[model samples]
Target: MKKLIACVLTLVLAVSAVGAMAEGLTFSWWGGDARHEATQAAVAAFTEATGVTVENTYSAWSGWEDKMSQYFASDSAFDVNQVNWNWLFSFVDGEGKSKMYDLNQVADIIDLTQFADAALAQCTVNGELLAIPVSMTGRIFYWNETTWQKAGLETPKTLAELMAAGQIFAEKLGDEYYPLALGTYDKMILMVHYLECKYGTDWVTDNKLNYTVEQIAEGVQFIQDLEDAHVIPSAETLIGDGADSLDKNPKWMDGVYAGIWEWDSSASKFGAALSDGQNFVVGEYFTDIGEFQGGFTKVSLALCIANSAADKQTAAQLIEFLLNSDEGARLMNSQRGIPLSAKANALCQTEGLLDPMVAEANGKVIAWCKNGLDPQFEAAALKNSDGVYADAFDGLSYGDYDVEEAAEVLVEGINEVLGA
Candidate 1:
């Protein structure tokens, strides 16, 4: 665990930090039903405690990224936002000016002592404290143990075994069954992970892509190899399934889609979606993916005050209350993963509020991933619903581009974002 070098208090504010506020603020986020419920409850409690009226706008994560992008561009963003780490680069300007407010302005109101300097550092841009991180996360494998048992195989511990199991599943369980499912952004993440393991390098370094066309072509081939092996469904099949996300897919819930490559923070939601008696177990990272071990962990989500907020202090108070207060901490539990705030984390520990599956997956992810993620790797232009990742993988899967051609398109599009 990273130690928090808590920001020291410089001023004793005269105003009551938790006092009633007259301004009505807007807050927005994206999550599953569980998170929405937990957060709304917390918001209600916050409102009761402090006379602040907060209007909430939240939705599923699917197209929420693009909608948030539009909100920022239109200068109509909510006063408080549940921001992803990459938004630091996505919403910032050419001169490094941030779209988020400098939290330092409300330092007297929010107890900055709850946040680690390291976590706070990732949310900073051009010396401005832009956002407060909620949790750290990395993608890890999760499998439906019951489905694997029915296939007469154990959860795969090696990449070769995983590909081989696809054949076994098909022969035994028929055409609709798959060992794993991945969407466009998931494929993008997996390809980079494969390359990083082979080359022993980060995906992006100093605003430039680290791999050449040929090297990336090899990664693209690996994705094609998975489809050929039936280890995962094609993009066309995933589209045909008509589910917005894997967790919401009937096939996944019923165990025909047996595994996922997903963020550790999401383990609970996915596990909860499975049919009764289906065992959802965390899987070991495949050691034979390449010559070296590789993956990256980053801030899972964060709270930010928009620069356009009508009342900055009130917005900061909502953040402070949600992350640092005992009432808010208990209500949130591990809905957002292990809290990055020391006070919240300690409270969860003492109250026994941690979700066992989420904690276990989180522990494995942080311990295994050996690289730092470049924020731009997940910038909206690259990871959004209809963005570069979707285009590259969709075109490849739909037969519009061969592996090499897809590599060219992927590289060109990434370069455009990096140069912008």
Candidate 2:
């Protein structure tokens, strides 16, 4: 009877030990279907290999930023997160303290040496390594060749040709087919790209607006000219489409919205959404856009561990596997942009795993865009849905604000955020 009791006690203790070792982590990110599927598969693989389970939450870009802001503010973020680079700066306190776990604590497991020092530097804040950068990205034009062909022209290689194609497209392919499309935020970024190229300066320097009121008005007018010339649909027309995103919009899928000033990292998602027989191609930076080549490259996204996580080492391990492991790298290839990890990049190039179009776009963005992005530029106050970018351009496009009035609103809003 004593031996029976002893055996029972042993079994109970064994089960308890198993339960203690079975802790799982929570991870979250925002992306399209391809990214969701790939990341889920990678998570499953990591779980199978290490018996470390992960629960993942994901959604498209629409409200993800606001949701993340809430999580971070409450100090209740998930164990791991796929973060926008600027979040490192945006989420910090006045003293520069961050809610991210100091990655130096988990250096024993993660291969930090795999990334470039310059790349890693951008992700650090207040002496804390806030995140691990996945890739660098910059905006460039991507065109649907089938749509351009319908207008009887090749994709434009110069700003003049691009503007000319707009009228030509309107004449030959009906008023519904536009040469390019720019949402409110898209216009904001493109304005910066235009101003940078023309003025040869960063949009923000030393936490102040670089352009004077008149210079900003000129930038706003340039966007207005595009709308007037039919280079892109007016705000009203695009809003009428009623699609959540350009990728889901019917006109884009059917080849009516032919060109986009989009991030290079987004090539696959956008291209895959096009109708069968349509071709998506990386386009050249127009030599005539400005006197100097402009635009800026930034850390497209990153992997981070929350300081509030119950298992910091486990979270770090997950990020390491997703970013640096052979299998993980294979699954995640070019989904987040070109890999910033030297090992992953070399492997992708040698094995031909990197998407050819993505590589081509990244090469062009890196070579021609000569400015560095300011972290404050992507602050939620400016870039979030229904934010200032909308306040300025939406009013301008709807004729509620003229060129000078729109510039006033834009400068005021930008300064408000920067000054804060």
Candidate 3:
């Protein structure tokens, strides 16, 4: 009887040790309700299969950055988290730094080679592969086909054509509608697309504040012509008093604007609006010069590990599962952008999980910074183009800025930001 009791006790202790080894690991991410639901489902499945418990914390985008900052500053590090590709440098830099695990450790598990060149490129800083990008973003021009016809023009194929179309809409539509709806609240996003189209991604990336005065003048001139022709509508009218007016802007939903410069992932949102009484179609991406064939670049949303983790191996497993697994690709679908992994993309395609337009859009995009820019330099140079186009393109209504002056001010602003 005693010998039997001892064996049972040994079994009990072994079970307890196994359970202790499989304790819950926490992962934090910021996403909308739908993303949270899908991602949690994926996590639950992963937990059940691996016999590991996962604790997830999800939040809206506005406060997510602060949440991450606090986590980084805390005693207990966040095990795994979502990070914007642009913001990766901020975390990995500085003294007493957040160290990223080498990708080579899990190369076989994660399949890094499966990702697109553009997506992989963005996630790589220095020589280390610090993160796995969940999806890629591409810039595209979205236009209302019905509105274009009303303005007595076909879809503009190039920048000149777009400007010409805008002039026609201004003359024809007048007060009934604006030629194009520009987001005043999120002016930076629109500015980046336009600046890239106008100057090419290379010029914008490489020049930074050091861009010769001529380049600034050229960008300003492009904006001036568009504004003078009434290509972009009044920012105040569309944006009201805030910095996030794209969804709330009636002109866009009501089918009054000619087009929009937005990300490809945004197509579905606009498409849904179209189903609910809005008439529109996403047009081909147009540049100031022409259709920018080389302008194709992917903006990545990366999954990164915090330097302070109790179990780096656990975090790596989560990342690997998400990037390389079929379930993970479906969970990330529209929320992340487009999956960067070849297997993930293939599985999504096979399952019909990908939106056709998104796939089409991805085929054309390239890396945002093809020349491999320093993140700080990229941020500074990007600020040069950010809202300058808004003022340059819509200065007539503001009456405080114009194309030429806005151009000069933009150069000064960029130069100042870059400490040039």
Candidate 4:
């Protein structure tokens, strides 16, 4: 009887020990190679320090939205998730509740003071701090100087110069080359910039379309003009090339596509894709376009804790380590753009971990942005799930619909999304 009791006690103690050491948490994110590598390193370092086990799920940008949507709907999302800034709006229901753990509730572990007020404000929905902003970003021009010089042209500083360079490229570099490469989403952003430049207004105001169908038609026409001038590749041509994304396209890597309007945070990946010795430079905003700056800046990505997480405290601790610790800052560097945490940003600077072009572009974009970004701007209805932006813009690009039809479709689709 004594031996039996002793054995049972030993087994119970062993189980308790295992439970104490099993601080398992799952983290999910989407990114390219650099971001994945950096994030894995950071997670490993955190695990080593805390004796916490972490399972990491990462992938490229493609299909992430649909995958995450399913996860959120099923309440099976990772304990810690990297979410788009705009997702907060859709993730919350009519009751203004979200499936995101309120970070403010875990403020003790996750150092909210490390972030700026503005950054924190962006993550708050219905008075709940749903997530923490990782970085601020805006789309801007990045040019391949090597390609431009080969075409015997300088980097363009104005819309007129950019248009002229298209003709120059066609003459100097042959029919296959274009001065710019833009995908469907890229076209939407560029069109917004042009419209804001021309009209001095925001894209949406108070959950409504700010521009009329006629004005939007003009924007679509401008995109057609660029395609006609050979300044940018046609949607049909890009689709026929069969590349999954612009970063993976051989044309972009080989300098056949000389310029991209991409997020400042994404500048490094695009630069890395170019051939060795190919120069990548940030181009100036078109000063001649308008009195107001044509671009908008907002949080690039946010770190959120899932409402269904089994261990909220452990998840919060992991977030703190990743966003506040000097070691985590060094490991992460600026792969997810610049860190939003003041302390992390300073640590990165002191450690010289920031990419120069990314840093410079971030500064330039912050200075040049004048408009407030809306969460609905990137709604799945507008951008992904048979999105209006893609349907109208791609139809126009493929010559299935002219400017007028595309404009009518765009306005109608946007209204359906906004319920206006």
lDDT of 4 by residue, 1-420 (tens): 999999999999999999877769999999889999999999999999999899999998899989998998788999999999888888865566798999989999999999999889999988999999989999999999999999998999999999888889999999889989999999999999988988888998888899998999999999999999999998889999899888899999999999999999877888988888899999989987667787789999999999989999999999999999988999998999989899999989988899889899999999988887888889888898368988998899888899999999989988888889
Candidate 1 residue-wise lDDT, 176-213, digit = tens: 89999999999999998888888889988888888999
Q: Which candidate do you rate higher for TM-score, 1 or 2?
A: 2
How far does residue 307 in candidate 2 sit from its true spot (Å)?
0.6
Task: Please list the residue runs of candidate 1 whose C-alpha ends up more than 4 Å from where it truly belongs after superposition.
Answer: 1-22, 93-96
TM-score of 1: 0.91
Candidates ranked by lDDT: 4, 2, 1, 3
Q: What lDDT does the true structure give each of the candidates?
A: 0.89, 0.90, 0.63, 0.91
Looking at model 2, which ten-residue stretch has the lowest summed lDDT?
90-99
Winner by TM-score between candidate 3 and candidate 1: 1
Candidate 4 TM-score over all chains jointly? 0.94
For candidate 2, write residues 1-420 as lDDT tens digits: 999999999999999999878889999999999989989998999999888989999999888988998999899999999999888887876667798888878889889999999899999886788899999999999999998988899999988999888889989999999999988888999999999899889989889788888999999999999999999999999999999888888999999999888999876788999989999999999888779888999999999998889999899999999999888888888888999988889888889999999999999999999987889888878886778889899999999999999999989999999993
Return the lDDT, model 2, position 237: 94
Tens-digit lDDT track of model 3 for 263-374: 6654556655543544555566554452333333445467777767777787778887777777777776655667777898888888888777666655555433222333
